[model samples]
Target: MTGNQASAGHLLRLIRTGEATTRGELQEATGLSRSTVGHRLDQLFRAEWLRDRAGISTGGRPSTRLEFDAAHAVVLAAALETRHARLAVFDLAGTVLAERTEPLLLEDGPDKVLVRLAEWFGPLLAEAGTAPGKVCGIGLSVPGPVDWEAGQVVQPPIMPGWDRYPVRRRMREAYAEHVGPVSSDPLPVLLDNDANLMAYAEQRAGFRDCGAFLLVKVSTGIGAGVVVGGEIYRGIDGGAGDIGHIRLPDRTDALCKCGSFGCLAAVASGRALAGQLSALGIPAASGSGVREHLAAGRPEAVRLAREAGRRVGEVLATVVTLLNPGVLMIAGDLAGAPFLTGVRELLYQRAMPRTTANLQVVTSSLGERAGLTGAAAMVVEHLYAPDRADARLAALESVSREPHLSPGPR
Candidate 1:
């Protein structure tokens, strides 16, 4: 292999993914001599990024197995809902060390939400018994469309006054203040749409081999997340899955948060169902209120949830035909049996037979943890990518406290 191809970062990736375990496997895979492989591996060991353990004997001699050291760093993840937030500290191996949920309304605006999230992160790390300096990066799941490269929220209907908000900058500064930053490297903050992260997490956890997977979130609002070939299909501007805004012919009189009428979310979201319930003297102000009523087996909420599901399913039929996804997962507050039943009714009735044949309609298995897990996983991927991993390893040797702006995940 050439000098660039035979870089230590490349070799670490192979070992980390288990493509090359033994020294012989590394030599065979990279076409480098045993001495050359050893030289590159030495750098990883000094950085405490790689470790070894005994391997099973294939024939006569047992081999040493190389592994990525998960304990070398930690990740901070926050899943921001329309009216709440869930945060956690996770190891690189995706294990949750500490977690908590709090009330954080989008109406409070971005500054308060981002700063409070950062401040709360300090205590969570303390509870996890992890040092502040161990944090490598943070991942945020916001309930809106996000420009990944720009690190800002796009024009979001529900999230008022948050258009093009500098979330990344604010979060980083808040971290330095609240978390007592001391690392030579600047901690990175990655942001993405909430539904997108949930889908990414679910696809990787349960349907990894599925070629195409789609998740539709039916909470306060409706949104869809698409995963193709194990990656989030976040179109050109991160506006790919805005199915909630698809205009419905009969809903022309319904006002939507996007300052438009006839949008699907105006008719079929949990908020919409809650509004219907409230009109009949049933108290339901938010998706959570609707969820509580549904959990209590309230007949009124169930009936409305089913109808909402039918309307959402109407839109999903067209989506299924276009994407031909292998698995369709319905998630969020309104993904109950009544809702799912209604969705299946319309989806199967309207969609082509071929689209439904291989499709497995299901609900969220990870439940509320999906977004938090996805956020942590996103951070891990960004930090350990070949090029970033090389820069990190180099930073470990040299004491430079310069902030780094990483390119968004593709």
Candidate 2:
């Protein structure tokens, strides 16, 4: 793309984020030439990507206020997991316009899951009246160790069928086949750990003021995502915050899916809760059942969950001592339970006094929507990254001029 298109894409990003103003403001935000800025703005305005309004006079020439066209751009977020899948469409402002959820077991088989996902997303987009060009890209959350650089899901222990799936490539192929030609404006797909996405949502929408934090998602299984200094701390092999497999000091018999023993998930996750509840004759097999039992004030259910909480807290206390994050966000169904309160109490007791004193543990604000919202936020963040518009505009310009710079055969 030309320098003019690059500048316009940047301006469009700013306006979409609700930060647009006069040409002076754009010039200040991005060090571009007055003529170049005007050229870009005109290009964007002509493309219907930006709408201008006359600002109130300030004892001088009235400045034209620019705003992004809300209907001009869209985002598709796909959250794929073991038990279910969720697809959502989000506008520029992070508002979810349309979403659909279905019980498509993701772990049954990778190829089957991929085909079904394509089918699901295609219909949902049609129903929402969303077109291919309007879509910025797709952000996906997967329940596995993701090799972000390779665009593949590394071996996930819990997923019996998905050893290694080229998730990014498959999704992009499906989108391109159904949508439009994969050109400079080709649809991009991003894959990240589901819990990491939850952490992103918590960072952006939840405890925004916290300097450092950890989000623990206690659902069918337990996992954590750490954000230190406003960055997701994905470790070597993208497994830095996989705390669920952390060994509980006192237990060695409980085994993890990763072929280990004494892990937090083995002893204190939703599966553990269900197991404990079942032993107590509570029949609490699912997270929803655990919630129902807690709501019903079932003593056996509460007792076992409280014990599970203490164990989870003990594991987290070690993390607290090591990382010392300012906040600990408990998410998923177990987050709202009194059992988690027990976990919090144990966390404070087991953690160092200074760490406990400074730390604040609480339930997630976004609740069930945290994962989905995080998926949407990932798209927004990717598209709005400082250099994203530059790259996108360059690619679009190449394609617009040549119209043949499509992805080469794999």
Candidate 3:
């Protein structure tokens, strides 16, 4: 973040983050001469990453105001849940142009799932009035812990048969097979945990200024995602927020999908609640079913949900105390009044007064769409990051000279 005005990428980042906007501001921010600043900005303009405001009067002539141009490319983002998938085409600015939700069973395995995803992108792009060549990257949100460098899930309880899969390669191959090649080099595919994406989306939307933010998703399974200093806190090996597997006292009889007993998810996850409700003859099948019951004012569902919240809250007390996040967002299926009330009741009582005093516990604002937003943001951030953007600019220049680059899909 220092003043290395030599990097055109650094200048672009300054413009994107609003640290600098005009030639003079760029010079002042980066401590570079006006000529050097203009030279760097010229690179950004040539790469189509920046634009100039033509008629802005700054106390005299029309001032040169720089802006990051987000209309030059598009991104494809998808969120995969246990029983459904949501995919969308977004411009670089995070605008959802075309989106669809369909039943996509995760148990179908990665090969089938990734191919189906690749096959869907072409139509989604056409619907958004874009071609495959216009896509800068793809982002995927999965309901499990992710090995980001390997670009695959790691022993996810909900997502079986996907451990150590070469997701990035398989996804690109599927796209080339179904949609055909769009460029000389392979397109970038980014993947992350669903709860992490949700937390990221929530943080970016409303709590970007908050230094510490926590989002707990209580759906078919329970999980937590933390955003610290405006970044996802994926602990070493990306297992930082797997709170569901946390063991609890005396709940050994309750079995978890992770093949363990006395875990938090085993006691309080949506799957666990659904099982309890089914045993009580209520016929609740999944988290969504429990949500439907809650919406219909089923007292039993309400009671169970509240109790589940309390149990989750019990675990979260330690988390909140440890992280001391400014915002604690409750998301996913069980994020309504009963569950939230239960969480608040227990969380506030156990955590220290200082921790609870500054914490703002709230429900989701973006709901299920949060995953899509997060995925898109992840792609945008990764592709547009300073170092990567510079590399991409170099590639663009190299691509321009290559006569064999494909123009579009079949």
Best model number under lDDT = 1
Cα lDDT tens digits, model 1, 1-410, are 45458677888889877898888888988989888899989978877788999999979778998998898778999999889999999988899999999999988999999889988999999999988877888999987898988888999988988999888888889888888763434568899988999999999999999989999998988898899988889999999899999999987999999999999999999889889999999999988899999999999999999988899899999999999999999999998999999999999999999889999999999999999999999888887788887887776645323447422111
Q: Write the per-residue lDDT of candidate 2 for residues 178-281, one digit (tens) a residue.
A: 65544223467777888888888888886767778898887777888888776678887787777888887788988877788998888877777877788877
**Better candidate number, 1 or 3, judged by TM-score:** 3
Worst lDDT run of 10 residues, candidate 1, spans: 401-410
Every model's TM-score: 0.95, 0.87, 0.96
The residue ranges of model 2 lying beyond 4 angstroms of the native Cα positions read 1-20, 29-31, 40-49, 56-62, 176-186, 402-410
Model 2 clash pairs?
A: none
For candidate 3, which ten residues in a row score worst on lDDT?
401-410
| Candidate 2 structure, TM-score to reference | 0.87
Q: Candidates' lDDT values, in order?
A: 0.89, 0.75, 0.88
163 Cα displacement, candidate 3 (Å):
0.8
